[model samples]
Target: MKTAADKLSPTRVKLTVEVPFDELKPAVEAATKKIADQVQIPGFRKGHVPTRLVEQRFGRPAIMQEAVNDALPDLYQKAATEAEIKPVGRPEVEITEVPGLDGKDEGDLIFTVEQDVRPEIDLPDFSALEVEVEEPTVDDDAVQVRLDQLRERFGTLVGVDRPAEDGDFVSLDMTATIEDEEIESVEGVSYRIGEGNMLEGLDEALLGLSAGETTTFTSKLAGGEREGEEASVKVTAQSVKVRELPEADDEFAEMASEFDTLDELKADLKEKAEADAKGNRVALARNALLEKLLDDLEIPVPDGLVQEEIDNHLRNEGKEPGDSHGEEIREDTVKAIRAQFLLDEINATREVSVEQSDLMGYLQQLSAQYGIEPNQFLQMLAQSGQLEQIFAEVQRSKALDVVLADVTVKNESGDVLDLELGGSEDDADADDASDDAADEAETKPAAKKADESGAAEQETAEDVKAAAKTPAKKTTTRKAPAKKAPAKKTTATKAPAKKADAADEKDAKESGEKDA
Candidate 1:
């Protein structure tokens, strides 16, 4: 066998391959046997027919076609490996010639494959790259917010006689109808007035509605058979309730936390808040550095692959292929593709690798986000053939960290910031906590939250400790962090809350829930 490659463009290649008749013999035999098993011949049992007789009955050309089709995938893979071309998306293949098609097995198998590939990238000197981020700071207001969040965890929901307001919890009975024909209904569902996770305009309609008051709104059904269809939704407030938080005193502190005094709890919250601010600064700096590289670099992206991604995105959103939103996302899609190509090249150059611990840690973080068991999440990744993709993502993140380490980052005040990208003491502690949590999860069944509106109220001190210890979501080239200066950082160099592909994450969560 032999292979040759022609450079069609910086990000595209065409490979031509030739194989001898002997290489096609095994596929030919297999194809003959397959046909024999399907055809009925007199005086011969199924699958016991002679190859020559099967060929005569099915025609030589049909046998040759089946053989070629059976062999193309492996042949193309071998040819691509030999040519050292890293194909990105699916390849367009054309079989130019096939051996044994003319009643003679003398000619060679010949074919050409056109494919998009990772482009060659020349990385700039990292030491020369510089970026500025806001100075890390923790104010009283921020600490108070954290304190309030913790307090909410122990708050009691008390029934109220007044109208529902923002931050109030409500028990609701909702029914959807089309032209007075009831389509769907749910009774006694607990919802927070301001969460906005329910139907659109629900918060607005519920506001100022007292217990037993009913209001009607027009909105599209988000799910069920009539999803996306506009309908009249009638909602009655069964009950209105307010969460009464415990006092921020020494006695309350002892009940809600490990600390015995309110001062001690506030101090710990302040320290965590400070760490969060520092993480935010590092995230900002990392984004600035990445943006600089993207702006200065010119990596060619394959138009065909871009279009395919755009079409997939639109299809996932249940929109037409030619939707105008495709155009809106085109710019982001191109940037994401370019960033992946860039980081991938860096990953190769720097010889970045994902260790077992790193992969496990990532899986644990993702599973926690989706509220599933870590082992179950790992199984889902393996079953979906996404383990490799996740590994690549981790490698890309580490590669970016390498680049960040060499770059100079400063705050707005022009002071050199000691940005701890990773491997910090806090990170190590978080990892330990996560590992412990995972072990506990494996040993015991997970406690499900009673209600989304009362999530904070259900959490214990241990949960709060784990929450404070965990870092921000790790980002990758595909899921670049927004280029905004955060009020407080969630991770040292992690991306914001959104995952790389929201749709994929949703699907994984749904599948994991079903499996559970």
Candidate 2:
């Protein structure tokens, strides 16, 4: 077998392959046997008939057709591997020649395959890059704010002699009636004034109401039989209370914190605030570095891949195929795909290995972030065929961590900040970042499933192997990235109060979608 590759474009390739007829003999024999078993022949047992006899009865055309059908996939795979092409979507195959149909000397089998391929990325020495992060500093006001929060937690609520106001806690009796019929009622419920945690307009109704005062307001019921229905709610303020914060002194500090004095507590709070600020600064610096890297590159993206991603994105969002901001989405998706590819290249160059422990750790983090049992989340990933994507994401993240470690990071004040790539105090919430990566996977464009044309059939063995190992998806976080990019810092988002399993039924169906 021999293969030749022609560059159709920066992101596409065409491979011409030739195979000797001898190499296809096994396939032809298999095809002949398959046909023999399905047909009835006098004086011969099923599936035991000689190949020549079957071919003589059925003619070589049918056998050749079946043989070619059975052989094309393996042949295509061989050609792709020999040519070293990373096919994205399916390939277009055309059988240009097949000799020996006339029972003469067997000649060569020839075919041409064209498909979109993963573009080659030229990665620079990312370790040499420099980025400026914000200096993590805790101002007195920030410390005071944290101190105030601590004080509020230890504060006592006292019965107030006046009407309720914002920040006041009120004990009230409430009854809901819809169309002259009572819906629900509660007695002695305590609510903080202006919290708006319950039905809308409840706070306004309670405003300026003295003890034993009654007020009626119309609002929609939040839940129950009359949910979303307008109801007249009558409320009677049973009592109003105000929060009284303890003074910031030694006694108060001793009661509220582990410190012996207010000054000690304030210093501790300031240190914590500074640490938090440092985390934030690291995230900003990482993002800035990635954004700069992406801005620096001129990577060419496949249009078909970009469009496919756009369509998938809009579809996932429950919008039409060509919704608004499609161009922006396309651009973003393209950048994301490029970033993954580039990082993958870097990961390979660095010879990064993802250990089993690393994968388990990543999944555990995701399990916590999604608020599901570890076994359950692992099952979901396996069921969806997303375990490979997750593994690739973890590898890519670690690769970025490597580059971040090598890069020089300075704060805005021109002071060098110590940034260890992994295991920094800021990484305590790295599991939160794993959630972001998973979410990004859920919304990743189908670059691997891009539209294809000009190929009669498609198969790429190398692609199958690579995909089985490294499926395409958003693998890392980025503020924005350029040609030669760096890692993005991790920022935590509030995990949903409800576990992901609550929506498992809805997600389970599409969990195995090719692109997240």
Candidate 3:
């Protein structure tokens, strides 16, 4: 057997393979037995028919074809290994020649395959890279913002006779109609002004409206039967109320937190804010490094992968392939794939592997984030078959850390900061899964943020539904609308795996070569 690869492009290859007839006899015999078990022959028990008899009935050409079809997978795998190419999708197999089928010659089986593969990357030196991170400085205003957020949790809405303002709570009745046909209506729903949790333009329309005032606005419905359709929504402002926060004092501190004094609470919040500032800096530095690397290097994305991802994104959003956002999604997908290849090359160079402890730590963090038990989270992941996806995330994160450790990070003040690579210290001596819960309590902020934000929220939601024995509770507090502004979230998007190679096996089964 011999296999060689020809580089067709940066992201594709053509593999040529030659397998002598001797190597194919096993597949031939296996195919013969398979056919014998399926066919009815007098005096010969099922699965016991001799190969010669089966061939005489089915013809030698048919037998050879079936044998070749059956053997393609293992042969392809071997060829890929010899060529040192990691294929992303099933190869397009072309059998150039087959042995002993024509009864004129018995020779090696020869085939060629064209497929997308992981591209070769010319990685830059990590040591030479320098990223400027924000100087770690937590102002009193930052701490006050956090303190205000905590205070809001314990605040009460007091009725006010004024126009609704930003941060004011409102009780409203809304009827949505498309062309005078009422599609949906809600009464006495509580909404915070400027929180665009509902339709696109509801917040803007709600502004400057007092109690008992009625207004109508046209906006695209967000969800339900009329999702994405334009609807004329008439809103009646039943009342306006403002959140009356408790005064920041010892008494309020005692009620809102475990701390007994306002000073203690402020001190704690300040400390947390500082830590968060550090985390933000770390995230920024790492991102700056990645951005620099991406800018400096020339990476070609596979066209097939980008289009496949684009189609998948549209499908998930219930939109057509030609959706307006298709080009934007394509650009992001291409960048993501390039980053994946670059990180993967670095990961390979560093011999990064997700240990069992690492995976458990990841699961623990996920469980805590979703407010479920670790066991329940594990069950959800297993049921949803995303355990590998999680594993891939942890591995890529560690790989990113490896790159971070090698690079030099400096703050704006020109001082070198001490950087801690998340999960690296305790990765060794991770003997107990039970201990992982405690270990994850100390994960670096950037790593934790990456884990939480890297995967789609829908994936976790689906998993939760599958794993929950009881239905999840319904809550009236609407999620604060996505900020009108895009937040700078430093997430290293890992490229998703192409559909499983099992499709290749199915293709072989359906080739009709076995019945030729």
C-alpha lDDT score of every prediction, in listed order: 0.65, 0.64, 0.64
Top lDDT hit: 1
lDDT of 1 by residue, 360-392 (tens): 876777576554567977776676444555555
TM-score of each: 0.75, 0.64, 0.72
lDDT of 2 by residue, 1-516 (tens): 989999999889988888899898888789888999998889899888887789799877667666776677677777787888776654556666764567653988776777788778777777678888767677999999998887766666678789889877777888999889999887877677765656779889988999999999998775565555789999999998776777889998898778899999999998888767765665566566666677776667677756655665454333577777677656557767666666666777885666665677677865655446789878866764455556667776666655676778887778877765545423433543344344444334432111111111123343322222111131111111112111110110112123212222222332212210
Off by over 4 Å in 2: 37-40, 140-276, 355-375, 422-516
Pairs of colliding residues, candidate 3: none
Cα RMSD for candidate 3? 16.0
Report how far off residue 213 is in candidate 2 (Å): 21
Rank by TM-score, descending?
1, 3, 2
After superposition, which runs of candidate 3 have C-alpha atoms over 4 Å from their true positions? 103-105, 160-166, 170-241, 351-381, 422-516
Model 1: what TM-score? 0.75
Candidate 3 lDDT tens digits, 140-249? 99999999888766666678888888877677888999988998887877777765545668788989999999999997665665565788999999998886777999
